[model samples]
Target: MAASFTTSWRCAFLALLALFVSGAYGQLSPTFYASTCPNLTTIVRDAMVTALNPAVGGERRMGASLLRLHFHDCFVEGCDGSVLLDNVPANGSTPAFFGEKNAFGNINSVRGFEVIDTIKAAVEQACPGVVSCADILTLAARDGTFLLGGPTWAVPLGRRDSTTASMDLANRDLPPPFANLVTNPPDGSDLIARFQRKGLSATEMTVLSGAHTIGSAQCQNYRLRLYNENRIDFQFAQGLKANCPQNGPAGDTFLAPLDSTGSTFDNKYYTDLTGLRGLLHSDQVLYPQNNQTQAKIVLKYKGDNTAFFADFAAAMIKMGNLSPLTGTAGQIRTNCRLVNPA
Candidate 1:
């Protein structure tokens, strides 16, 4: 009887252990790397600080770039570090493939790859193969936002690196700066639909749009708005037109801040929206006169900085959780730009 009872207890314990491992494989946790890579967060934060230091040629604008990188990565293919992959040449067994780097939305935009490479090198030095590039990108975004005067949140880790990337998906999934401009009076429906397709709610979309408070837009992106749009502030349009030419690609690459305070991450984006001074057509559409629901949320965020920060942090956490490749689903790439050789 004693032997039989011990066997049953052992069986039950093993069952529970299996269940835990399976759950951990699928779900993300804040302390996922507590024992393996204890200094992971510090390593990423230090690298971001160095990257943003102007003395070394780093720009505070890189903070926005880093955040944008993470968002772009997550939206297409579930935050699997696919955006970091370079275009692969066609070998006998493998087919030629292009990556997100040259996609319509990312070609001239979506930079900061060098900063990520630096952080990956530092992480590799400390923990070697234990950490994944996907998690590093996510954490880097969080650290960048915080370093740029944005709210910080606990990032759930355990994401693995993807083996492949999709340029087609990147083009399709990423929201464009000129989205929803066709209607006589622009609306947030298109932007809302794009975010909803990614499992983000409309409110989450509005709050996430606040990320534009930092960074700058290129002339080509906003020239149409400047030349023809009537909703834009007169002075603001004139200021942008001075840098962006009326025709041709001469000043296409010229940049203008997305907001008055483009270097700082703040609620001023909502303020710009309320005054019809939003840099992108998609931005101004959020607070359109017809969309009272979105307008109310924008006003709420504009008035209460604390509330915006809190909601922005929460929304970011939710966005990070989208379709992550957790557990044994993917491999951890030694180089973020290339998949490990099979």
Candidate 2:
């Protein structure tokens, strides 16, 4: 018995060919944290950096390294955008600066919404209504946390943005770089103080300093802590004599290669912090005393960089969601820059 060629077989073959071609041109839906959600992981991640860049004093905060600062601060609870939004009224100094201990202000920190706006503007051109601005903030923050040696826990997509920056709430939400600020006793925990508040121990703080492995900083941002000659506890080594001035009102480019791998992200920031070469005093404070645990973490990383990086990732996951407004409480920005967009 012989089999005959049938029209049905030909039709089936043609259909198979068509399916293959379609799949080749158009991929299957992306895999988001949620099954029904399409893959917007990349969209959210890229959008976050874009939004984060312009917020840190524009050109000043564009570096990938500093974004970790945003991640570390926010991840203590949720992505509250408190670190970025200081325009709203606060109990003391609404505009807080990261490097300026004397005049602490949060002026240039970029919020998730800003990143959402820029990313949306770009993603809109690519895929309209396929992604959410809220997710981008979280993804970028998580990725940032990861880069800074923090955990990379998965966050769900479809998060909404807030309509307003919470100044009253912001102060409560975000920890200042220097707490208990005073001339004597250096009362507050520097960066370690805030890190502790976020549930990370001193060891985590020391290891997290590895984030400075590849970022740029405002000379003024690190100057007070690095070029200290005024008996401010934060003092610079004589090796930095040529770059930073021994006077006031400094400029950028005062320091170079803060870590051995200043161009790449790694645990070198921890090593530098141990040597008192940390750019920010907050970074240096995680050593020898109240932050003994953090100091141990740094020493451990000094011997084993891998362990430091691992701890950093865990801490980052914890940091990104610190006091974040999710579910229904916050507004999802169509554009991250202008509030609600006119």
Using lDDT as the measure, the top candidate is: 1
In candidate 1 the C-alpha lDDT for residue 288 amounts to: 80
Listed per candidate, the RMSD to the true structure in angstroms reads: 9.9, 13.3
Instruction: For model 2, give the RMSD to the true fold.
Output: 13.3
Per-residue lDDT over 260-335 for candidate 2, one digit per residue giving the tens place of the 0 to 100 score: 5655556667667666676555555555456455457667887775555555554443444445554556664545
Candidate 1, backbone clash total: 0
Model 1 alpha-carbon drift over 4 Å, by segment: 1-25, 181-189
User: What is model 1's C-alpha RMSD?
Assistant: 9.9
Q: Candidate 1's residue-wise lDDT over 168-252, tens digit each?
A: 8888888898887234454433677778888788789999999999999898888888888899899888888888999968899
Highest-TM-score candidate? 1
lDDT of 1 at 34: 91
